[model samples]
Target chain A: MGALPELSVDIGGLKIKNPVIAASGTFGYGDELAPFYDPSLLGAIIVKGLSLRPMPGNPPPRIVETPCGLLNAIGLANIGIEAFVGEKLPSLATIKAPIITNIYGHTIEDYAEMARRIEGVKGIAAVEVNISCPNVEQGGMAFGRDPDSAARVADRVVENTTKPVIVKLTPNVTDIGLIAKAVEAAGAQSISVTNTFLGMAVDVATRRPKLANMVGGLSGPAIKPMALYLVHEVVKAVRIPVIGLGGIMDYHDALEFLLVGARAIQVGTANLVNPKAAIEIVNGLTDFCLREKIKDINEIIGALETKGEDHEKKGDRKDKSKANF
Target chain B: MDKSRYPMVEEVVSIGFNREIGKDTFLMGFPCVALTSRAKPGQFLMIQVDRQAKDPLLRRPFSIHGVLDSNRLMILYKVVGKGTALLSALREGDTISAIGPLGNGFTLPGPGERALLVAGGMGIAPLFFLTQVLTRAQNHSVKMFLGFPTSQDVVLIDQLKGLGVDLSLTTEDGSLGIKGLVTDLWDQTLSQESTQKPVTYACGPASMLKEIAQKAIARNLRCYVCLEGYMGCGLGICQGCAAKAAGSKDKPYYYVCQDGPVFSAEMIDWEVM
Candidate 1:
């Protein structure tokens, strides 16, 4: 009977209608899912990572399914910056949601050049620096593994583009918190915690690695819990907003990240599982808020009740739940 | 390429029937009017075997086997892995999610042209559907050569015969028609044919298809092949199913999910594939 819950969220300075974002690579260049649903319904859309030149990606047998997970070595195959801006951006710009361009490079200069090319592009609202692609041989996860290199990639992108810079971190690191702090200190406005975890599978009969790249990134429900812990760690380490993503298949998973203080959440492999996943999460979040009688979705952000909390507050929460239901 | 002909639908439809036709092979049909009405012969479906389980995280791709009553879509699949094993366990009335008429289908033979369908093992899934379409056309003649490992692996013998096509069967064990591969029949069949405009459509193992592609190219015959690969998203998004492009300088790979589950044999680098 009251107004709908407020779902809009601000990822640093970039504002979106909700907190469910379509992760890069999973949601092609924003056109692939048009048949399933209107992409503008999501908080934002991150197109596949683009480089200075078109990438052919890895050879066939690039993906294999594991227990509750998917191992993919797509090798960052994309249509390049020029093709995207010229071919995809015009149509994508028509959508109401903010379009964030995910960029990666093989070198520091390649990263800076990609940032410069899309700097004044009219449709692009933000730039997500992918310092964390595990499948690439050169600059991808190499830059993300070291704190100083991660900061430099962020600093260069921030310098090249006026758009808000979001440094996406790789989970295949010793201390993710240190990398988060370094990128935040380097002037990145926001950070998306956790790209796919490095993993691989093998065919026992053939004794051959499942992926052509030998090792690929593991994603899906198998990585959700670990991703949540990493997101929580990054949130505690950085002052900038954190976008949580790993194995976010539903709204419950999205809420886990938000409770840990992630500003938004990206639906990656889940999109491959179900193209309507992000939109479904958006609907689920609204239903959750309405059921709980929460006025704004942000009220639950970082509202996790840890151990040793006041007994009186815990009692009040129980009493409120009993009365609301 | 009129997009309207191939309308992609993502729906959760209930299974109409699931029957085992041969060893480790099952023919399952679901009543999806949206898919059955528009699905072409060589096109396929991405079926989520178990909607509630996550171990088999991704959907399994199946070629459109046939249509029943103009509303039911059927899939002929073998239990080669976990996904198909789970699909085989699914019974009538159970529900599953599927996305289809996903990729391009076979290009139908024109009037006065002869249709030659070559299927090896489970490759018969799509080619069988093509045979059904080809036989229905007034002026076209359909000749099918199907090869399986043994007699027990062969399926749809009566049904295929009911269609009244010139069907030849071959089994490696010599338990069915011939003791040799299906390509052995190619020389005899092609030499006996009087039609100069015979288009070849094949689906099966890469090695088998490569041999057929080579023979077709040598004879200057028009050939199209239906390809299969492990796919993440049946839509072109994941880029997981990359097939080497033939002699393409600018683009090195063709996404099997989008470009062609069905392609002209000449378009693929047969040696690498």
Candidate 2:
């Protein structure tokens, strides 16, 4: 009846027009994707991972399709930080969306240098610290293993960059809550819960791994439920915002993350399936708000209500376990 | 090429013809004016055949085989897996969602220069369109060498035969023209040619392309090779179809969908790639 729902979201101070941001790696430097639709229409665009210097990434057969998931060991392939600021940034300036460049490094200085270079960029909304790449020899999953290393990596990037820092955590960790708290303490403005899960698929015919890197990060619809759980877990553990991702295909999937406690959602593997998936989700969210007669889309964020019966069942289960002991 | 000038079109196109052309190979023609008119030889389309299903969530990538007219386009394919098998089952008039005129097409050989095209199996699809494009120029001398497993797997011979170019075919089992690989015929053609170092264009399996590359290198000739991989989004954003381009000192991985499904033969470091 009125105009429409407010789709704008501020993830721990990084403001975007909507809650639908294109996930890194899936959406390049917002160049190839521009033909499908104007990326500025999206909430934000996270460019491919970047290092201090240009990295060649892994060998061929880097991406393999399996079931509902995609295994990619792109090994943080990028043109380096200097090239981005020099060449790619000028082109990305045309898009109206906020740009959040994803940075990965082998050492803390590597991360700081990338962030420091990105700090002066005009259009960048924030810097997403990638500490979950499983394909690389140094950094990646190794940094996310311990809380201290993860915190230090986060602290270093934040110290160098004037813009807000969003740490993207890995799903391989045992306690994602502890890692979330660690990054928060290190001044990470926000955390994107659950990067791709480390998984390996083998070809029966070849008797070798699907990805040349031996293992790759798994993203797509298969990991959505697990990613959602991690997002909710981190949401309860930290005061900062949580950007939920991993396997989000449509608006309903995005809505679930928002209701469970995510401030915003990202579409990763779905981009491979549908080039316009992120923008389509943005449109779908608007349609959902219109149908539900909600004024602000943010009202749906962390709105999960606990029924008394469900709480009683949880209490009863705990009491029964104690009684048996 | 500015890709936006081609204009991407996604619509349900009616199939004009769908029939078995060769062993495991079929040609499906659809009528879509917007896409057919703008499509170049090497460009591909992402077709969604099983519209009702989600298990095969991503659309299948098919290179533009040949343009029938301003309103119709053909996609020639072989049934390799679940996606193509699904594509083969469609009958005439069945509508499929297609996104196209995507990716940069092949760079045509210069005028007065001789052109050599080598293709294997279903890889003949794009080369067929390229032959027609080259013929229209009416200046360059065109020669084609196609390879198939046997006589049964051979396809589009009649169409290629009428093109007025020097066309040849080969089969592995000696059921066709020559009793060896297409490269054998290519070698023979080069040995007894009067044309001054003709540029070569090719499409086929990896092994065949590698073989062709070695032959091209031995002769010190430049070749353009079109490659295919497990592509997710043919739009290049996915970075799924990445082919390692051998740079001078910094060998960077180029997105095959973006940088090229078609590239200079020597640019790709086949050994490590």
Candidate 3:
């Protein structure tokens, strides 16, 4: 009741400062956005997806535009796991908040190798296994689409690393809940819902695809509704904590996911549009909870229940009448 | 990294509505920009266009076309994608976000130095400002070779002429000037001025830049080429604008956002380009 309690939330065993994590590929390593925004303000940072070896990523035209969204096929162009530990990790240790590394690989071996390397790095609070990279021919969307593949990939990573594993799920799948359950069953500490949507943009003039890879993963505001639906469904299906992200541009949008049962949220495409998005969300959440007289932000996490409602609960909910047939 | 040095757009002043400069080019003007960093020739601004636009959510990077410094700045961009297309429809007083004086600017030679300015299509945007700088210096002998698909694509020709530089025109179909890419004219020009060590400056498509770099290297001339890549933050954080470069001692892959959008021809890892 006093100042919205603390904004702190626990993911795995790691206690994040807040519920706002800079979504993968948006914040880059902590140092990139350091000039524009204060890095210590966020709960955690999920760096760009890293693989076993360096990836040049896709050819040019790797990005295209859609309504209120973007499609990118960067193919996880990173300095590889070795450089991240050797060069990037040391820089991360300086930041005050926990750093969550997002790992992506081409094969099970690739994931295992990266997991082993990152497990020992200091300041890496947890690891988010990205099984939904569609640009790569193998290991990415291939593992994420099927429950067994997703479980096996998650299991291999959890086996190799002592660090907490939060398997990121892809919305492109038919059953996101099934994938979340599989990931949790495979020993994933938490589940991060929704990577990017498999979408394409055409030049219309040349009658050719906008991206060099022909099709790219779509993110940003356009995918918000779908991401929220997936997060709601996953939180209901899984016992483990769920980190929701997709077109989370403002605090209210993030609150929607929290009310629907997301333990925390990641700001992916929004970081690209506004560098100050993550900071604003953190401040806004604190302000909202304070104004509403709600003490733990966690109190709202997954508060939605379908059980037979009491009369007092019905009176508290104004929208319940709108739902009345 | 100087925190205070970063240039943030003070305000989005001018919204250019459907102001198409060329068939593929669009113009976005900002009446006010925070001049935190001094912009020189070849430097650029990472323009976040239509933050409110739903599709094409990312910002588009553009070379600093010209900055008046009174209370506003103008960016000459081509509508190559959704970002710029949305920018083209902006209004005069509407605000647009921009981060700038980004990437390294073009390196000019000493006074009275002879230099060849080569540009293709919209690549000419950055070079136009470079021309203004060079002509204002009046120390360098400047000659410009501009190439286009056809005569119609020859934008900024009259503008370049007004700058009072030795300008030559080329189009593929021989509609306006010479035929073929800008390098073709450079090849012939280099043959005549073979004796003088002319500093080469160019901005164009990757293919065009590669060919120009090859020709410059073959002639053993010092050249700086403006390279374009997909950008995220425009401020070096995204690492999305990364390009490989041979380092002096330790680091090899240099970030285009930090190290350069303009690099010495020999320093580039040509294979990647």
TM-score of each: 0.96, 0.93, 0.87
DockQ of each: 0.65, 0.44, 0.37
lDDT of 1 by residue, B164-267 (tens): 88889999999989888998786578877745869999999999899989888878889999999789989999999999999996788999989999989888
Model 2, position A36: C-alpha lDDT score: 68
True contacts kept of each: 0.88, 0.53, 0.43
Given candidate 1, what's the lDDT at residue B28? 95
Candidates sorted by lDDT, descending order?
Answer: 1, 2, 3
lDDT of 1 at B247: 95
> What is candidate 1's TM-score for chain A?
0.96
What are the per-model numbers of colliding residue pairs? Answer: 0, 1, 17
All models, RMSD in angstroms? 2.3, 5.3, 4.2
lDDT of 3 by residue, B8-125 (tens): 4323445544366677676555555354236777888767656555556677777888655454455787665666666677766666777666778898888778989998888888
lDDT (10s digit) by residue, model 2, range B124-217: 9899999988987899899999999899999988899887778888999989888789987887888888468988899998998988887897
TM-score of 2: 0.93
CA lDDT, candidate 1, residue A157: 94
Worst 10 residues of 2 chain A by lDDT: A316-325
How much RMSD separates candidate 1 from the native structure? Answer: 2.3
How high is the CA lDDT of each candidate model? Answer: 0.90, 0.85, 0.80
Residue A271 CA displacement from its true place in model 3, Å? 1.1
lDDT score, residue A244, model 3?
A: 92
